[model samples]
Target: MTDCDFLLVGHGIAGATLADVLRARGHRVLVYDPGQANSASNVAAGLMNPVAGKRFALSWRAEELLPAAAAYYRALEQRYSQSFFTETPIFKIFGSPEEQNAVLARSADRPWGDFVASLTTTDPNLPGVHAPFGGAWLQHGGHVAVRELLAALAAEGHRAGWLRRESFDWTQVQFDSEGATYAGQVRSRHVICCEGAAAVRNPYFGWLPLTPNQGEVLDVECADLSPAQVLNRGAYVVPVGGGRFRVGATYRWPPFAPGITAVGREELAARLTVITDLPFAVVGQRAGVRPAVRDRRPLIGPHPTVPNLSFCGGYGSKGVMLAPRLATLLADWLVGEAEIWPEASVQRYNALQPAGVG
Candidate 1:
């Protein structure tokens, strides 16, 4: 007999979020985490914005995702008796007159009123920031303390005897007539891999088009910038607390190293300068690989042949807002309550791989 209902092979946002959902439904879940120091969830700023880019386009499924994220995190807070998610709006400064006009155009044509909370022009004399063309308030946007969420949720799981503080060995996982076996002892009815960018190293699901990108961000301490909201111009400045903000987030394809580079710092500093004239000191820096995919959609669902083995990853930068909603769906699917979304299902990529491989 299987020792548990589910064996979760990661402890990042994707796995942790799903575990919460499944456990709430009374499923037996065991999580194995290697405690990777540089996991993306550990280093992420955890910002969830509805509108983005120079044109201020609405993010994918913003209407549905924003509310779901807010509700889920709020529930998590009540469960943990801790505070983490903050509903801070984003003040996206316009770069140029043309860009300002572009936003106005988007607001008129698109239903931007739903996500673009407010829009206004700059006074030019505005202190600290260089917003001559003005900015907009992105509504229903906020940042989740991902590190806190992971830590708190892990603690909860550990207390409930569902969290294992160790790396999962894929070689030790065996699928047979009974179910999935791991470490030659523990047996599970199902195993879901949520290994983030590390999934690229997975032999079974590695065949998926996962483009792990290296992202670097700087934690800065600037007393002059606004802590009430996030500043998005050339780069983002998210308030971490008193006089400190998380900034930068350069995306480099084929990420080389785990350490922060001089080039990344310089590039971020250049953008930070454009955002404001106030001097700020870099208090800390972090780097991690985002589990992004070529299709830019989430990777989910069970293996084609091995029904007990599944995956839930490729969330990339939107893990905070995306994971919970997708996890709910996956949980429903696991219980035979619903089917997986086609776009995120592993079967969608089955044709590209050799027969029988997930």
Candidate 2:
């Protein structure tokens, strides 16, 4: 039998980063990921947008999250000797004149100014796109090769003898006063479930309102698009490399179903012309489930009743920008050095609906 300090039951951004942080702090960690087909991290476009949504408001804790994410991914890239993060600009097309004025007004402020590189009116003459309504080039935004980063971390964990490429059977979990045992072979002082969109079925944390949001993306090839540019008009067209771009994504809520759909493709295809006039050949299509919560905040902290059991999920599309910082916070809390954010803490839900989780 082997004993460790933590057993993480997922390898998405949250689990992988948390494991790395814990291991860096000299804690024994065992990460389990079966690589589900519906993994959002695997199929996500991994956009690190500091200013998101219709109001163009700064993301929650954007100042801290954005730079922290950039620095963290950079460190991961250097450690793995791979390229995964790109600090590119987001040329966000405005919808109307009112929208443009609002953006410009915010750009004059201190914090918003830091992210607003330049503002465009009636269109910024960028290639391959028809932005008649103009756009703003948002700085400190970038794309993260999420699948690549997850794969890299998995390989490193395998090399370090802390990650398992297999499924964790909850039936085998036996909790004691101190920790829990897996299949009577491995013992961990704590078990944290970072099961992304599949968390709706997580028995311990199922009570939380983890709405599974489905998003589908398309990979297209074009001859004239620049890989250095990212065009954002709600749904974005991100250049991957070598005349290839990723056009996404369709946010389907509730009655969620897995896999790509023809309707989603048609929707993106129709909107593609609005974003750009360049002809493109659809190279590939992918769909994944984002673990979106009811309140749109991440689910973090321990179960209300289960000892040494915790849940970390519900990051939705913001996982790329948010996971590293949240993971660090959870790590600090785990070792008694800090408290979890009240908004993101699972305790909020437990307080309201203690009997909600099955």
Candidate 3:
């Protein structure tokens, strides 16, 4: 009885962008992922930053979620031929002089001043790595090699049979009034729990207010740097293309533990030894968790008490630029067309709970 209309429970990146937006609206999802060994969009380095730094600001909805998440990952790399988004460009290295006068006072107050640029002291392309008080490019920041786009969208949803590698048995999930089913073999009318951070063990969305965080990364190789951008200073090297380099990220919170820790590899090798003494070659080390939400936004809707059980997740560090416009607004609010992001509704935490609490 493997019927389906939706069952997606975490294939990461918000259940592979809501199963490629409900299979491009033809609708008939099934996905049940147990992949990425406990996903955080698979130890993400899938950065899509649009201006973010200690106080450089401007990332929250960076201009309508960065060109609708780069035209939805270039239309899923032209309908699964596969490339996994690239666009790269993000230098941002300025150790001081108050971050080089905070990028000329944030480009004379344009806020993100058109993705900022022009501010250099010169490194003539990688001379011994560490730049002196100069760096600011950002131009359409990019990156998304999330494990080769979640292994090519879980091998094109298991060659279109719609995927189901295992582990999603909430007691074989069953709900009446003809809607949810699962182990009874997928009779789903709705049930989207893009369980990143395991939606805190979702019992109809474990009481909402999640704040998980746990990150940790490092995969150095750094073949003497080049114009391969994405290298913000205090942790964030990202280059990953042969000469390798996907350094860092360390953000623990609440007793989290996705593994890797020796105090997070000595706090990302002491922030990559303050920019670079050179000689790199770590190889690998990873960790997950990040389904953050402490007003960092992103929780999506439907399930104050389960109306077909919906929920995207708290996209902590901008899950690859807010999971394709909140998975096309949670597949247009599950087909009824629109309306949801009222600050990522979950009825805004049911209007701050209380009144007969639940």
**Which predicted model would earn the best lDDT?**
2
Q: Report the C-alpha lDDT of model 3 over 1-358, residue by residue, as the tens digit.
A: 8888778887888788878888888988888877766467778899888877777788876878899998989888888788888888888787877777767777656647777756675553564568776777778778898877878888888888788787787767877655888766568888888887777766666667787888889888867776378878778888878888888798889876548877888789778878888777787888888888878888887776545777787888788888888888878877788999688887888765444422
Better of 1 and 2 by lDDT: 2
lDDT of 2 by residue, 63-155 (tens): 999999999999998898999999899988898888888887787787888888988787666777888878788999899999999988888
Q: Candidate 3: where are CA atoms >4 Å away? A: 3-6, 9-12, 17-29, 32-45, 48-51, 54-91, 101-132, 135-144, 164-186, 193-229, 232-296, 300-302, 305-308, 313-317, 320-358
| Range of the 10 consecutive residues with the lowest summed lDDT in candidate 1 | 121-130
Q: How many residue pairs clash in each candidate at the backbone level?
A: 0, 1, 0
Q: lDDT tens string, model 1, 112-223?
A: 7888877887643445878888888887889999998899988777787789888888988889766688977898989999999999888788888888899999998889
The count of residue-pair clashes in candidate 1 stands at 0
Would you give me the overall lDDT of model 2? 0.87
| Model 2, runs deviating above 4 Å | 352-358
Ranking by TM-score: 2, 1, 3
Runs of candidate 1 exceeding 4 Å displacement: 124-127, 356-358
